[model samples]
Target: MTALQAATRETFWTIGPVGKAAFYWLAAVAVLAFGYGVYARFAAYARGREDPRDRLSNLPGRVVSATRTVLSNENQFDGDLYAGVMHTFVLWGFLVLLVATTILGIDIDVYRPLAGESFWVGDFYLVYQFAVDAFGLLFVVGVGMAMFRRYRERDGRLWGKHTSLEDDAFVWTLFLLGVGGFVLQAIGIVGQPARADEAVSFVGMAMAAGFEAAGLTTAGAEAIYGVVWWSHSLLAFAFIAWIPYAKPFHMISSFANVVARDETAGARLPNVPADLDHTNAESLDDFTWKELMDGDACTKCGRCTDACPADTVGRNLDPRDVILDLKAYRESVVDDPVAGRRDSGVATDGGVDGSATVSDGGTVPIVADEGGVIASESMESCMSCMACMDACPVDIEHLTSFTRMNRQLVDEGAVDSNLQDVFQDVMTKGNTFGESQSKRGDWADDLEFEVDDARETEVEYLWYVGDYPSFDDRNKKVARSLARLFEEADVEFGILFDDEKNDGNDVRRIGEEFLYLELAGHHVETFADCEFETIVCTDPHSYNTMRNEYPEVDFAEFADDPMMPFDREEPWNADGETDVLHWTQVVEELVDDGRLGLSGNELDYTVTYHDPCHLGRYNDEYEAPRELIRATGADLHEMPRSRSDSFCCGGGGGGLWAEHDEEVKPSEERLREALEDTDAGDGIEKFVVACPMCTTMFEDGRKTGGFEEDVEIVDVAELLIEAMEAGS
Candidate 1:
């Protein structure tokens, strides 16, 4: 056979035994560093307090789901398509190369020595070499994309407040390393006899021809090949070692975070333990293990910051910074103990038990308004909208730690005068508006039929008429319209009348923990007096807390008190069951079941619907209200950022009471989004809202922004009533 027909191969340890020995020594160090880095992260987690939520149940399923989520880049794509594409190429290409490297190691170390034959040969060799080059091409392209996007374009989305030289180093090194692999392959072929078989490795073969044309003799090629091989090997090992040290640290942390993520994270925020002393996270030490680890997983892609309504509107809150600051603080205490300070890690029974945490350092406050690692003002600026969590690619529980800091602010009495007033009103008057409890049912006074008190009647739907609907004059009209509409539908629903207090949804979000308990606990007590199958409310805030967070409260404590209106067998939330729902969900179900009849299309105005953060992002109830809108015979022109991606109205988490310096309020920003994003030719004449807070914010926005003539703010109930009247 001629030289052209010979097989193509690179023998193992071509530079001799000394070079091979040196490579092994370096590989050992890199592997050791990587192992220790991983260990330190997990060991440090033993400092945090245990989250009571069982994140490990159905462990296999979680692993599979997380694997799918990462592989598919499911959550990443929806927020920024360009970033998502970049991630996809990087992740898949990297995986392919990683597997190829592992196989090469086995072929050399295990098969050749023991079996006396290289397994990477013949048809298998051809296919394997071709696959490596094919996938390596993708890895090269992805790295180039990353480098150009980060350095050339200086894309603001990739550069958060924590942009560092590490990011630059990471991208440049990875790009060089990726391109270097192909170059090394070309060198391998040119340094040997020409081969027909190597043609299957198309990219490598093509490059080898170029190297031959460049006057590279066999001896010259061999010299260049040794240097290139060592360079690639050292760089590859270095990259692996750097995986847990630099920006690429997300590679490990992100996968672990995703695996441990709770599907109901923000919707059902973690319950504050009754016996815990670190109620206010004075430091990184006060956070739960998972909460503390959340920071280490941040990709800093800026999706959370970009999607943040507060950040978008120029409010002080930056979700990415919040995580990074906390992360930096955690890293600062690495020398204090294996566990930093708090003994909260859930690992027990030989897992990294946090109970064994050695307390060697004093406590430090983390959320000071003036100069803390995480400023209280940023926490206050949070709307509890969950937009950050929704947009996070790694499923970082930003709301969990964000709201915990808010609680600390509340503990320190650092809240602004406006929030302070609302807290006072809730404590003294049993509601935010400070209206008399006797006046709660006054909105239904002019209704065609007397609304049955849940206290005096058994009902299918115990409508929790919230503080705004029960007392605020504007929402009272909506309350009345809903009442009349329910009557028309012949729905079996009743209200608590003067008996109910605020459910403390916003109060809980604002960091008034005990006050929220007082309110939510009292409402649970009030519910014991009534017989109802389901709890429904027009206030999505009330609905959210009751459905998700209320399970944390043990209403059985009140069951023993003599002053309690009724006897109870178990704690109200002991079973973790409460069929809490928003009124739109109920009405939509009614409409589907043919219980609530709607009129034909008489109110066919081009319209847009505003999703309440509580109902849409937190509770996942986007479809019910939209279904109701379609039933109203209106031309439903949904805003571009509608459904799960809907913008907040800025009235939540005490934003209704507090103030900010943004150029436009979140509500006003949302109004502009609806007007500009809706595709109605005649212009959107109506903005329909499902939550009372949304109604208040958008209506105020419409008036304040001089868009009252452009679009009218109306509740879904009012639109239904309009269609109901037309049917009549």
Candidate 2:
């Protein structure tokens, strides 16, 4: 054969024609199997209800965003550092190896066949050779770390009831592939007469030298290389086919999940039909296809569960279990409807235990004894803090799943007594605390400034004093502070006073979807009568709900009642549209514009700010509250878990009213964490909060945890007002 023909020969050196043929055949089978597995997964996903998750119009942008997230590894690093490093190495190694394989395939299949010579031959080939070997080593190292985590560390996050042998097999498969590839290359290079220079593949060269030192002959090395090469190739094929069947299905589903993520990052309660029937998720079929895919997309990283406040307090709810349980239920029912059904009085062992089949071949009950896929205790424990969703690297919306399940539980009247009372109070009295609507405006009665009722006067800003601020005695102080700030800024704002209703942010999260809609619709109706350019909410919950959810509620209700005042046709916050602003955000703007002046003594009181779930994660307004606090002339101290990682005060999702048996509450845990360095010279003496719920929870925590002597919990407005008073 000509020199060019020799150069263009198959890339493998020792593999005989039969071995190549066998490899090609196995590869083809793997591809076919992979295709079938993927098809089956999609078919399972198809069993779910329709979800408008795809943004086809902005497909290119979505792809770019997905690619950026994957390549940047931003989500992985946002939580645990050790896991992030391990994941980064594994991800980059796999990506590099995959790219190298593709290039090699192109060279062997197209370039060599057409041009009679491989394109990657000289220095570039050496670099390519080095790069592949280096990345293969990296892959092995990453796999080793993962193995350590699984075997030695045994992190509960990765290994638990949900984990199976498939998890181990997935990691082992990659490890074997990486180690086998390196060993095969080493033996091949050593066996070849023409391959003298070994440094180009440094890792392979070291292994080759070790083999040579062990007195292995060229023929023996060739035999070993032939066996190892095929072994590596076979494992690769097996892994490819196994991608869809096992826990690693996340490898395929994660991309789709990220690209198809909800447009808004905030927890969105799925809109239920106004009709009573089919209000919330009752079965697998009730969930949106995207929600079902969320089960498939989970990487089992445990970040969500770790960030969960309920889980932190040893509550029945585990965010990870919620997704996995739903996924398992969905998968079980995909092939056999009877597999996931709970027939009334049909006799069940209450779980996946016995031969209690209902004649349709199903051993597991869909809504096992633990209430449905999740126990009622677990469902009730959620604070709707969005911590779990924010911590998830794969973009799993645990809040959406929780809310959907909540809807079902509520519709079935399976809620706890406290929640039942809350529902009744909000529905009947228009507030969560069971206070009369007439008392909502009573907080404003003592303020020297005349607070205009929006119903009677036109105003630029309609100040929404949510439940706690309107009714709770402690929070009423915060309400008055904000009113004073508004007056000082000369902002033309009015309150809805007795006419206002609950914003229903927590109500929606609590699973009372219809009630939340009714409340939101009522507020929208109230806004129609009041001439206002903006709605400023003192409570973050109200701010989040008013800004993000109320518009949708208005639109949905407008269809039934055409006389609704807010123009349904206009875009949210468009021309002639009312803008929604959180109190801290507006106050920060005023301070920035030199309209609201405050004097500060940074040395007098060093403070730390606790981010409310609704304000920080739901609305992404971390900086504004801090900006306001800093503007108050106080030295800002930070807790370790602040901003996106902020721990919940345990009062969100109506958790404030709910009773807990735990010795240490999630709020108490946070209080202890906040008091970590109080003995230091610049220690935090006061805990600053922007959300009313946060203010209430932390204050109670200070008392319950015996932390009052060390740190005082105060609202951001109160602190600012104190500074303003001192300046005056």
Q: CA lDDT of each candidate?
A: 0.80, 0.78
Candidate 1, residues 412-458: lDDT per residue as tens digits?
Answer: 89988889998898777878898888888999988879899889999
Which whole-number lDDT from 0 to 100 does residue 568 have in model 1? 45
Question: What lDDT is reached at residue 497 by model 2?
Answer: 83
192-307, model 2: which lDDT tens digit per residue?
Answer: 75665646688888988898999877899877776677777878998888888887778789988888888574544556654534535655667777888899999887889988
Candidate 1: regions farther than 4 A off:
1-8, 337-364, 555-569, 573-578
TM-score to native of every candidate shown: 0.93, 0.93
Clashes of each: 4, 0
lDDT for model 1 comes to 0.80
